[model samples]
Target chain A: MSDRLPGFSTLAVHAGAQPDPTTGARATPIYQTTSFVFNDADHAASLFGLQAFGNIYTRIGNPTNAVLEERVAALEGGTAALAVASGHAAQVVVLQQLLQPGDEFIAARKLYGGSINQFTHAFKSFGWNVVWADPDDIASFERAVTPRTKAIFIESIANPAGSITDIEAISSVARKAGVPLIVDNTLASPYLIRPIDHGADIVVHSLTKFLGGHGNSLGGIIVDAGTFDWSTGGKYPMLSEPRPEYHGIRLQETFGNFAFAIACRVLGLRDLGPALSPFNAFMILTGIETLPLRMQKHCDNARAVAEFLAGHPAVASVSYAGLPSDKYNQLARKYAPKGAGAVFTFSLKGGYDAGVNLVSKLQLFSHLANVGDTRSLVIHPASTTHSQLDDAAKVKSGAGPDVVRLSIGIEDKEDLIADLEQALGA
Target chain B: MNHDAYPDNYIRGILNSVKSIAMVGASPVNVRPSYFAFKYLAQRGYDMIPINPGHVGKELLGKPFVASLRDIGRPVDMIDIFRNSSHIMPVVEEALTLDPLPKVIWMQLGARDDAAAEKAEAAGIKVVMNRCPKIEYGRLSSEISWMGVNSRTLSSKRAPAPTQGMRLSLNRMSVGGGDTAASDRAAKNKSEQS
Candidate 1:
């Protein structure tokens, strides 16, 4: 709202939110209705024709969801945002807009196991294909690209292993291929890394995780950097072609910078029908207000835990990039100077039994399939999240039988360590 | 915002009353948009009749495929046209020949014909053009709100549902789907043996 750029915390609190004109409501109230009343006949026509901007229906747009979308877009330095039901839903809609039938997209090999399942299995049903490349080997990404490749997808900070992807290097491959680079910034959030600033054209998030800062709601968002030239080659027809649905108006021509976001909402979300509830939007927005405070503590506590585990005789390995001895320490410093985030993995010398036992024994941590909460969480991924994946996939995702994932929260350092110590029986 | 564009009340009413849908031009191929729409409609508990000529007597989503609207041999509530714009007239003509004519003639995202719409309306049937049923069901039922988007209408009231021993966690975490600790132990033991 001002010429002077406000800090992240301020944007988290104030962006896209103002006092309610009708009721002076300070807190964002959930607009829980199925339909909004029209002022006049002509007004309704304009909204549907895309001639005017307002809430038409919840599936397409809503005022409260608009606030969350704006807050996230501002924080991520994107032109606009479209919030959806889950991280998986965001990915579905993002790819739906980019790829047609039989088209392929290259993805970094190291990623959240659920994402791997989504890309490998569920997406195939939609006729979209995935070609995998190891994040460690940047050249693998280049080799995977073909004329049919429509986009390049990677994570800012990969899940489980806490590895930092070379966003800049992969972005070059995407640019050369004349495709957009999509980065899932769920782990890093905008606090640790802004993928768009480096070279990413689009950023996606599962606000159900850290951005919500609580494990209470499931939500996701797609932020359009508004940088890609959708009209460059006419490859993306959804954005460039005329649409009979909305009176043949090309989305890119009408909604300039954030045309991708518009297409996702109007076409993808409209048909797929994964709309985020306003109640969830309210909760996520509330969680994000204190993101700056929570993220710093999460990093500090995680660094301490990684160090403790690395030295433990019973611990076989610790895989947090925050640790000086970790393989991704330099990348972490370069990409996420503030911290390498709070989710990391470690393996036990006692093996599978020890991994399962540690999760069950931790008092301060809740054993569940979630991360980025105010409360510490732990899970044996092999027996839970990645239980569905095969052994090869488990290893590729950094979720092996001996591995235990830790989502360090904003708890006291000593308390978390005490819980870990008791759990480890050291 | 143009208020006259989407007739919310009209669409909502049709979605509420409609029960069964005969999806014409439905495909068995997973990649086809018709296939996804058919699956989504079926998942939403719609009695789906997939009409694909080549796949007659075959099954899509466990619903036996029919060669045409007349071949359904049952009272069809709605005829969802997934065919191209050029095919709308024949589809509507065939839909009219059903034993009990369908109450609605719905067109998919890009399929629309004013002549067919007029014909259907003259027969006292509702016509929804250039729209999708999968999306309409979500909007009408308020299920789309699960994704964190605002539904726009606000109320302090909530519908009661059956809940027992369920802790209201921050994230809407549900109880286990009957997977017991024994199962995990068995899986782990099998892995260890290998």
Candidate 2:
């Protein structure tokens, strides 16, 4: 596949996906169905019981989503993929495989606000605990560890505020603990960073953002590095031990290296039922094909926007890892060498009200809670996404009262800057 | 970047697996907040030992009340306080005295005793001030599972089931045999209309 697609441009337009045979359509079709018929009762029984591998239901697997999965896996250099309902779904599914009741995992404190909620409250209800470690302080991670920890997670480039993680160092810690490293590669996209290359055993993405490109669909994906030794630990019963639901078939033993992906599909998706829509999968597949091109342009536009805000009289500070003056710039250069990504935070000199005014005034940029679209987006996170968080959590997530988050898109640089300028002026 | 000295993978596994909880100021009265709070948690399979010398040796909410933390036979994962902040230090002190201390000391809502919190914090316990686990659970997960709504659903009512006979009557309006002003106007309209 790599040989067939020699360049980013070639890969974007033609990788993993082939023309539809039945309709002769070049684009991937949306496979909208609740269930699929097996060849015979024996095949159905085999699929249901894990003796054979095929789509038993739409929630477990789909033909259209499979193309998107394979494409992202190819792009990220992973063995296999799992397409989920949302990025949050991807995280939940991954945890379901790695963690049991009373298990724990460590995550970087600097993550998306929703992730904080999921880890702190939702996962806690199930007895899965998350130990918070500062992404900047790798030692805190080691100090926080107890005997029950199962995995280490971080974002390649964190959301809202684009702070790059030292994946290599974190991966080293995970290796020492005999655990897998999971990286949320949504912000960096595969074009900006390949987490697997930095030693991340699993890569997760909210495809609704960058990979979907347009705000039309919602989806998420998880890619397995096929690197972690699941069988080594007696910890993961769903993967290492025989599953009772599947007639005692051991996923790790049967799938060999890509057992994590197989487990996510056959077990997590089968039971939990957070399956991505085929239309969403198709849209994300289309977006991913042009990821390299859009990502580069998105970076270019974002860098210009960051530079503009850094010097603006009305702006107090800008927080893009791409900015040379940024504290995380050095880390960004090492980890996400392609680009520091499109999302960033900037504070208004006039404070919170003025930030809201600027958002209301901006015409080109949509004021929604979403990021990674081809269209620029702006939001006062304190008033929206982080509103549910208490003051302590809000401050920790960097969504303070005066801070305004922007997700730069692949638009004309001058037009985007001019819009920001007009909005800031108003 | 200064790496966190602690490895992450070894830290997260045991943060929430609280095996035992010492309920400070657990109530004997069924209507009190402490009663329901203790009951919900005790129902969730946590080893809950109630503390309130007033209710000592009494079995309320299905758990026996003890005079102090020392009275409990085993170590606990957390300490859930239903008492006010001012009266917490002595309990926290006793909680700290146990060998292999509790990991979390959660102060119930309206229980903001900073002095006690600091002491617990100093003792390496994660202190969650003024938050209820039951409320957090309801907000975070679907523990209720729509069972309450489904049980009283219209179709399920008036069925030939023994449980529904009382459930249907209790769920409907209870009209007394003697008509008052409110019922007389409603009853007059009912008699004249048909």
Candidate 3:
């Protein structure tokens, strides 16, 4: 009644959750059921025909996941969102709606190595060609735009390196090319940078990262900004054309702004069958309640670690945008004013052996392929996550043999600094 | 004024306030979206008037059809435009000519014309674009949740079952919130037993 919109922290806590209707449980209860019972034959028929909204099967939707979807949608300022099994599943589902077989999508060369692999191998086999572009070179995205291009993909903060991308510049290119700009906001999270606010039409996240905060759950979400006109030029037939499965209803015409989320749900997730478990959704939802507090600490701790690494004798350079001397510092200030995020790469003066040795010598930092945990994580990506890529590809993705990627967690800054010092010294 | 997202209260207000609605471009065929919306709203006890040049002499769901807003002969509470975006300006201009202009001008899903919305809003008419009333009604009434749609609203209170007919109310008390009188009583009773 006050006409005041809820603030970020308030929305984070209460956006999509309510006390139980049947029981008074304050926390979101895991429905934990596969299918929901209908009132009668008409209710079942309406749901199947997309004439009504409700839970039919777990593969399509669930109440617990709906709450998570709404919470993320509210946080990102998007019209709707869909939760999936993993970040890779979110990408596959998102692209399935946009790209047909043989259609091409332009992507930033610097990305999560897993994503690069998926785009190159898995997507390629489906006839979805990925045209690589340089995120640092804005014109490269424009150049990669061919008639067959359906979408442009980038990261809000590039993985491993923690570099900032000029989202507005690429958004201009996407607007000109008549394509939606899909930004992977997994690294930055909504607490730091909301991609939708920076001209991203669709924002995807690996909820295993900062959003879940604790890194205890593996989930992914795709938020629909509802900015792109999918019906324009009839380029996106999946939305504009009638969907054969749902009684020939055109999604864009029926659902309007949230049609992309609906298509990803009814078409992609429903068929592909990579639905997030109710328990995982509940775990992630609990994690998100503390997102604002945890994300800030993660940023603060990361800055301290980056500064220490930059001054260390064994370190050649720190790639965190939080450092003033970093190449992406200005862009980071413009886009993520709060902080440059936690995951960043640093190179060792001792080269590949030193990078590998430091990981084993670390006391507190866990040497793992994952990031965005409550505990500090260190990874020699070149030998692990990015090992499949060739030498040039590895270096291009900021996972050079000498580079060490650290996901600084919400720990005592001095303790984190001391651990790095002992490891670098040894 | 941001048509991209409308608060729940704003939409609930429009649906609650409006009684009679004239749906422009309404179709007699059951397959069309306009027909579905018209049928749904009619069943919900609204004064639904269908307006279509092609279906002027026909009846839709036991209601007579008129060719245009001008032929309705009675003032409407709202004008639901189901036409193409390019065709909105003329229909809005016609709505303004009525003795007591409609309280709202609603563009159906995928039908948006910002210029027309602005013009109507300037004349003291509320405008909502690129949305469907049927969806909003089901969403606000928690009827859509029966089918598993994310209404983006949370309520712990169960919606009251229809007493007589298969109709739900837009003016229901449980629009949002988990802590309602019924839910509170249920919680209190459970605690006592436990």
Candidate 4:
């Protein structure tokens, strides 16, 4: 293929797939088997030795999943990609490769509450530390970086609160410290932003959300831009040092550009065993096919909803980057020109009780913990996701008690507004 | 098909004994299949030495190019030929002349020569013609099944659980495995209490 690349719509449909070679099936078949038969013992030896590449078991790799991996890698302009069980699994595996025991990584404070909980509590058990930095303040990222910092993580569009991150500015800080910049592009998806174009070394996604567009599949992906030199200063041993388990093969010296992706597969996913089942892979792949159409509609409806909320007397504040009045509007214009994504929050004038009441009254919007579904969704973080966090911590995480988060869907704008209007009870 | 399918044990033996490979006609150009094959094998931890006379002094994927298989300085265990049908004989002839000849001669896709194969086999070197090491690795490793191709082997037993940290679950209800608020609270309380 020449430099004139295929458009997003085309890549979403065809990138890592071809008609089924065996049966001539147009759709990718789900290979549900756990292990594959070897041609002979030598073929098996080469596979086990890393002297060759192939799926040994579903836990390590699968046929249906590989297609999804390639499709996302192609869309993100990454050299290679790895597909895992969920969006959170993507973060865990990516860090598993980067952070050694007792090491640290900097993350933006404005992240999904689930991620904040994951990084703050779950990761600590693995001996990995999270140093929080304000995404709005680029300098805060630089200051958070210490000698132990292996990576810097941020969401392209901060969850709950629709905010765009200054990826280029923060990437520079990561560059100065000789670490990779990883951007979680789940909310914006590749339709709105390709973080690699903005200097991110790796782009991650919760494919279950917008990419799947249906919220029916639980999947995650790690896309390696193949930019970072893992061998530099020999900080990343999992990639640099000879792995004794794999017969003393050093991943970086061998893999080069796709080494990080390879490391995540053989080292992280292999050991952690958070493998995506082939059935889920097939569903997520089907969902990705309509990502472009669904994302555009999701943004259009969200822009309308954010505007409606901004005007409502019952609403205290609408934190949607699509609105010019919102704090992240300028950054949204620069980073996500298509739109600032569909998931955003609006605080109620009645505070905690109003936020809870508004969600309960909404007829169309499902009150659920998930996002990026075709149907709109609403949640009160103060009562559910962020309930455990103290008030001071909750505010810092953009999930204050007065906030009501909405994951606007690809429905008609007028119908969505009417539902919200009735729910506001004005 | 000009290439013979060797026994599984023989192929396995060759791959296991060999440590380094000298890829003849290796290209630095990204679009070429040779470049990818070279990259994939190198990443799999093979000491892949790319031999390209055209880009004599240049580096492909960080490793400097060598003028010929003989110029790799160390003992090359395998010679992976990426040249066409007409050039295979000459490439094999060059491989035979090296002080420590390669133990195997692998012809890339469409690069086969019966005479060269006879020569290499006569020299007690294993010969795999019109086949790619990259493809062979994947096929043998069972990794190629991800493409919906049939993996001839079948087993009924499930893969054993990982011995390390908590097992990750991807079910719809609990997406990050055990990332429920209750677990978070427990972990948080423990941290504060400590």
Each candidate's TM vs. the true structure? 0.69, 0.67, 0.89, 0.73
C-alpha lDDT values of all predictions: 0.79, 0.73, 0.84, 0.78
Model 1 alpha-carbon miss at residue A402, Å: 0.9
Model 1 clash number: 26
Q: Pick the candidate with the highest DockQ.
A: 3
Query: What is the per-residue lDDT of model 2 for residues A1-426, given as tens digits with 9 covering 90 to 100?
Result: 011114445545554454553565667778798787777775565456543334667888886887777667657767578899999999999999999899889999889888988999999999999999988899988877788999998988986688888999988899889888999999998888888877888899999898888878999999878667676649788888877776566676454445688899878887999998988888888888778889899998999999999999999999999999999999988877778999999998999999989999999999999998989999999999888889887878789999999999888999999999999885
State what share of the real interface contacts each candidate retains. Answer: 0.00, 0.00, 0.17, 0.08
Model 3 lDDT tens row, A71-163: 888788776789999999999999999999999999999999999999999998999999999999999999999999999999999997999
**Model 4 per-residue lDDT tens digits across residues A1-426:** 012334678778876665564666668889999998776785676567665456689888887898888778767767678999999999999999999889999999988888989999999999999999999899899899899999999999988787899999998999899999999999999989999888898889998899887978899999878667676678999988888877667776455456688889889898999999889889988988998899999999999999999999998889999999888889999999998899999898899988878877889999999899999999998888777678888998789989989999988999999999998874
- TM-scores of chain B alone in all candidate structures, in the order given: 0.74, 0.64, 0.84, 0.76
Error of 2 at A181 (Å): 0.7
Number of the top-ranking candidate, with TM-score as the measure: 3
* DockQ category of candidate 4: incorrect
How large is the interface RMSD of candidate 4?
18.2
Give the per-residue lDDT digits (tens) of candidate 1, residues A340-393: 999999999999999888887888899988999999999998988888888988
Q: What is the DockQ (computed on Cα atoms) for candidate 4?
A: 0.06
> DockQ scores for all the models shown?
0.01, 0.01, 0.14, 0.06
- Candidate 2 lDDT over B1-194, as tens digits, reads 00111111111122236768888888775434565566656644567788888987678756778888887878788888887657777878888898888898876644556677778878788776544554333212211111000010011122222110021112211111111122123223322332
